[model samples]
Target: MSQAPRRTVVVLAAGEGKRMKSATPKVLHSLLGRTLLGHVLVAAGAAEAEQTVVVVGHQAEQVREHLAEVAPAAVPVLQAVQNGTGHAVRIALEAVPEAAGTVVVLNGDVPLLRPETVASLIAAHESAARAATVLAAAVDDPSGLGRIVRDASGGLARIVEERDASAEEREIREINAGIYVFEAAALRAALGKLSTDNEQGEEYLTDVFGLLVEVGSPVGVFVAPDVEETLGANDRAQLAELRALLRDRVNTAWMRSGVSILDPATAWIDVTVTLEPDAVIDQNTQLKGASAVAAGAVIGPDTTLVDTSVGAGATVLRAHAVGAEIGPEAVVGPFSYLRPGTRLGRKSKIGGFVEAKNSELGEGAKVPHLSYVGDATVGAGANVGAGTIVANYDGVRKSRTVVGEAAFVGSDTVLIAPVEVGPGAYVAAGSVIAKDVPAGNLGVTRAQQRNVEGWTARRRPGSKSAAAAEVAERAAAGAGEVSEAE
Candidate 1:
């Protein structure tokens, strides 16, 4: 009886991503809601590999830190230098104890790897007992890729890089996909004799195929079902293309899961952004970074939510929310902004042109039109009218404003920071309140108005011309007296 085969996954994630030109490591740059490496690791796990190891090089500590947060169970090893892909694999091999089973190789930058594809490659390698098995694809143009050379029996014989291929060989459309599954013993022996005699002066993992063929061991090829899964991100343009593809996948999956996307083309949903059944999303809406929209939630004709959570039956109309949690049955603006730490309770209403930051509004709280509530706490059943501003920042420090239950704040009211309005209190319209109001009291800060009659007519264009003429006549009389004295 044959024992269960031991399989190990080796992930190559040591590239500096100079083309990305970002301070963050390449694999850490997010695709959809997850880092690229995160996707690769998930795929590997889904393939049912026994052991998985990640090789890290540039910004090793940062990569480790990110991986710890995203996937702590997977093992990690340091490459410690800028080396070729083959050399990176060798560094990863040090972490593996046995070399008898199969070794699966994957690229960290290729986030589209499917578990089925990887499983198929492993099956082909184990069943054929071949020294090496390569994933191959017939690309539109294999100009700069390694060409797959086949033997007389149509088995994969070797791989010739673009620079080394002959004129005729260069025209081959079947190219190496850079994904491979190798027999551990054969891989170790080949890597032992590998040399960096080429122009790049760096060991090439492709060299293992040639070694296997020369040793009378067969080198096999497995064609990918979809070639796009093999494409790796090397720059921002490719990264953007990957992002668009992932967004398309997310939107399509959501549609199939009973969500109605009115305009799928204009809608952008991150990889982990979830929309439950019956959820409707309008055009120009972006659900980003792990946001969740429950059933019956209707999101914008133009809305953007980042790291936000919208509960069931919530309606967000033309709003922008970031790091906020909107409760069930809540209604947020045609033009409202909810910033970090903002929470809107159930049945609450935030009307158009209102902004809230680091604030909490209780159930039934209403802040309608042209108001700014920051660093404040508002109780239940409270009503704040138009043009109300909570002066949260005083020159030196930020403060808070508190409004109790059933409080009525009038239009054009200013709730100075560090002030409070007690329950059942009413603030008069156009009041510039500077102090707290007791329960059941009415706060009115403005002095009595004194209106002068005909003030508007006095300032009209025609009346202003008459007033100018009278002033000119008086000046002329004074000039005449001065001339007589001269």
Candidate 2:
């Protein structure tokens, strides 16, 4: 059996992206949970390149750090200056061996470029045995792009950048998509001949097409099936457009897989976000990093969840949760906030405006409207009333509260932690319990009421409150006289 060709990929990620107007590097700008360069790197993996080299510039240190996390297999080479695309690719190729075959060169800004597309390009290049093949796309607005100029035989003759092209050449709709596959030896030989003699005083990668044709080598073009796949973002606005396109693509796929996305345009689901069949995604919801919705789970008409998991048949609405686990049949929100470490059990309910963190609510437990349950655990069948507060922090240290099974915590009560509401205990409404309430006991802590005679009249003479008190006292005295007569 013959040995397969040694494939290599050189990813050019050296641009400063001045148009992005961000303190962070352009390739680091994120969308759908992945940075621009990260998406390209994933697609590049499709080619199964034996050797992968990433050229970094303009915040090279940051890019390298991120590469260490996302693409550890790839080698990082610094293009110390913002020379040009050609210069970047040349540096990357230099890091590889001389005999490396079927080298794929690409820009890191094109996030939508799919892996299958990369595979197809490599297949086309190798099967034709061409010196090079340019990935081309026919875009409606080809402005600011390098136009693809073909010869009489309909083969790629040359690539002309917009600045250097004549009016007729600029009118050509087919543009070079800035992705290419080159024969290793041929590319190395051509790079040495490149000069900064273009309109921009830089070594234009487009010039290499003309050089290859002069040597009587076959050069070809692979036009993209989807034009948007070859698109790259230059600014925030363009990035938004790309994100919308990606969102549509992702949501549509999920819908096809039996996930109901009620409003595809408004629902932004990350590419990494997973949803099982029969899961329903409502309008204006964003399911972000590490989020998964089990079958029969319904997520938001308005919600944002990150690193959270919702179990089967659970309902989460208008809630913002991060790093939380919601069990099956649990109901949350209509304005709830679940912070990190929150775990709700089956059939539990966290109602309107409730906020919980570092807490665990057992099965059948309930924390209804206007409550904050933090650093606490509510036992199964416990009912924590509306407006209840678990005071877990006391300035010096954070403590915990444990409400046992079948406990009844009244509305507007505060459970001062280091305390426990024992099983079957009843906490009176509007009470603040600082000590533990034992099983089956009624815990009530409130100051005894004392009504001082004529106090209101003395305190506020001639005031509306004094007038009302005087009338009440007169009516009481009259009633007393009638009782005496009887």
Q: How close is every model to the real structure, measured as TM-score? A: 0.88, 0.94
lDDT of 1 by residue, 266-314 (tens): 8998877878999999999999987999999999989999999999999
Residue-level lDDT tens digits of model 2 in 1-486: 988888898888888899999878899998998999999999999888897898998999999999999899989999998787788888888787664789898888999999999999989999999999999999999999999999998988899999999999999999999999999888888888888988888887778889999999888999898999999999999999999999988999999999999989899999889999999999999999999999999999999999999999999999999999999999999999999999999999999999999999999999989999999999999999999999999999999999999999999999999899999999999999999999999999877888787788888999999999899989999999999999
Measured on C-alpha atoms, candidate 1 has an lDDT of: 0.88
C-alpha RMSD by candidate, in order: 7.1, 2.2
Model 2, residue 221: C-alpha shift (Å): 0.5
In candidate 2, how many Å is residue 302 off? 1.5
Summing lDDT over every window of 10 consecutive residues in candidate 2, give the lowest-scoring window.
Answer: 91-100
